[model samples]
Target: MKESSVASTNMAFTDCMTPTELPAEKNGMRMKNWRNRIGLFLKPNLSKHTKNRSHRPSSDDLNQWAQSFDKLLSHKYGKAFFLIFSKSEFCEENIEFWTACEDLKTITSHAKLASKANSMYEEFIRDEAPKEINLDFHTKNAITQSLHDLSASSFLAAQLKVYSLMENNSYPRFIHSDLYRGLCVTSTAEEP
Candidate 1:
């Protein structure tokens, strides 16, 4: 049997929407602002979640998704972005195909919208803080730990079971909490 690939039949659904053209300086500023906003909202919660070290979960999948999200937003909202939904209207028909596209579409769109909003806010509202302050090393390390913790919380054979569960909607939520929110919020905050 051949390994299954997550490819969407609907090309439109998989495309990402890019933002309007902007000078390099302004574009960098916009991303910084968005990163700040997200960072502020998630830092408090994600920080606590990262302290437990007994767990040692791998972040390969999460990292891949994050990279894909960044690539989409870099377009400046010109192309269509998507997130593959694990369970959706087409779940019964295309199962893997439809779901992957939906989740990717949703995630990419969100990241792009967030970037745009931050860009507009920085231009009109106020300048954001420096980019270096919002590091998520702590959070990422913690989540990696928690993934390992879950297995202890469950049986050995069921080890990879919870891992699969992590792939659903919660993955996005987790990413936002651990990565985007923290990075975005910190960069957007102004220096006192």
Candidate 2:
């Protein structure tokens, strides 16, 4: 596609998104504002800098994402897009911690396991850490205790809690967002 055409399509989608609503707003206006804000923020942002640039999701990928959260997480582009959308919502910690737990599980080194566990705990599970999740007291304490002699599965419960949080919360909002919806809508429009 020509740069001019791409710009116009970008404009069209941009036009459809309503302005972001304020936190004090209610009902229909909030969603309207969210769509508008996200449309602008995500505005044709096919980043040249991303590792997945070579394998950006096709319409098939978007459709697949709509089917299941697991499907979305499994797709590189879908995960990247979802991460971006989550960041916009200021809830990236949930997914970030979830990803950290995943990475932690792959470690064969006891040394690395303890090191990564402490880092993950400080980063997410600890109270008022930079990007905290709301794990229950028991779960948090158990993970904390395990930190002294951590195993790969030490963070499993906490990980599951965060996964359930995302699967039940952000995943639903994401599927219906203008960011996701517009991508699906515009991608189809561009199809032959």
Candidate 3:
């Protein structure tokens, strides 16, 4: 697959429009800001030696990522690699927004839920959000309405939408990229 494959979200193909009707993008341009890029780059590499460490991900994790998108996101090493790879593709917002939704699910405090809900909206759902994902009018409106009285489920629809976008678009590209293949190679080289 090409490095520049299908777009994760082409806003024109919102809930109201049929997939067939969506226009073929000629330039293949997507909104990507450097703030997200720089933030992701600053994190320490998970594979590097540390004073205190947990399990260093095995080649098996890299192999498993090939099996499914869920497997890639579920494994820490795989997820870290995927995030970096996605960022290179200039669509880091999709994963960042999805990760935020997953984090939101773990919160029990109503105050925190409302706060997180609004923040996710501002960052990923609002019309001019810094990392806005392409969403239809009704879905965006529905989420906005729910924010007044929110819960973990307030962003469920949006989260699922982003998840689907990544799965259908980014995940495949990551699997095909040289970075993923190199990780698998390096992990196996350490064995035997």
Candidate 4:
């Protein structure tokens, strides 16, 4: 399609999303401050930005409306409803804010959980990667670095996915169990 046609189509689609008609299908998300709050959040935004930014408010109304919609959906549908977005969308819009009920400290704590997972992946690859090899040192390091990146990315993908390792009783659970057991054993042995 032509650029102008695409832009117009986008505008029309956006116009159809009315906050007043939100809270449909008992999705559990509510629009607590459907109008005012969204207005503030999308205050400085323009309509065009929304399509490009992904979950971003193109206008003030969209933000306030989404916040309200989310609240209603959570109340009715529960936590499972919020998993509609992919990880990129969740992170972009800061999904944890409302999911954890706006607790900044808890949000930070969850972030640490994700960060710790990433560090674990990196550390595993680093330790396993060969130090001395037939290739040049730099080349070996580069290959190891790629391996590290792949491991870390996989971990993140698993965590962010709603039905993935986040709740799986397999690899992640085993790793955590092993880690805690190791810590406990180390502390006991060091005691006088």
Best candidate according to lDDT: 2
Which residues of candidate 3, in runs, are more than 4 Å off?
1-56
Clashing pairs in 3: none
In model 1, the runs with Cα more than 4 Å from the true position are 1-21, 40-58, 64-192
Ordered from best to worst TM-score, the candidate numbers read 2, 3, 1, 4
lDDT tens readout by residue for model 3, 1-192: 442233324423321222222344511221123224333333344554544323445667777889989998988767777777666565678888889989999999999888888888888898889987877788899999998888888888888988888887778777886566656665565544
The Cα error of candidate 3 at residue 130, in Å, is 0.6
- Candidate 4 Cα deviation (angstroms), residue 46: 14
TM-score of each: 0.20, 0.73, 0.73, 0.18
* Model 1: per-residue Cα lDDT over 36-133, one tens digit each: 54343333333434555222212332344465543332332211112222111111112222222233334435455445334322332222422111
Ranking by lDDT: 2, 3, 4, 1
Question: Model 2, 44-132: lDDT tens per residue?
Answer: 43444544423335678788899999999988768777876776565778888888888998999888888888889888888999987
**What stretches of model 4 exceed 4 Å from their correct place?**
1-29, 41-94, 97-115, 118-151, 157-160, 163-192
* Candidate 1: C-alpha lDDT: 0.31
RMSD of 3: 7.7
The better-scoring model by TM-score among 1 and 2 is: 2
- For each candidate in turn, give its C-alpha RMSD to the true structure in angstroms: 21.0, 12.3, 7.7, 23.0
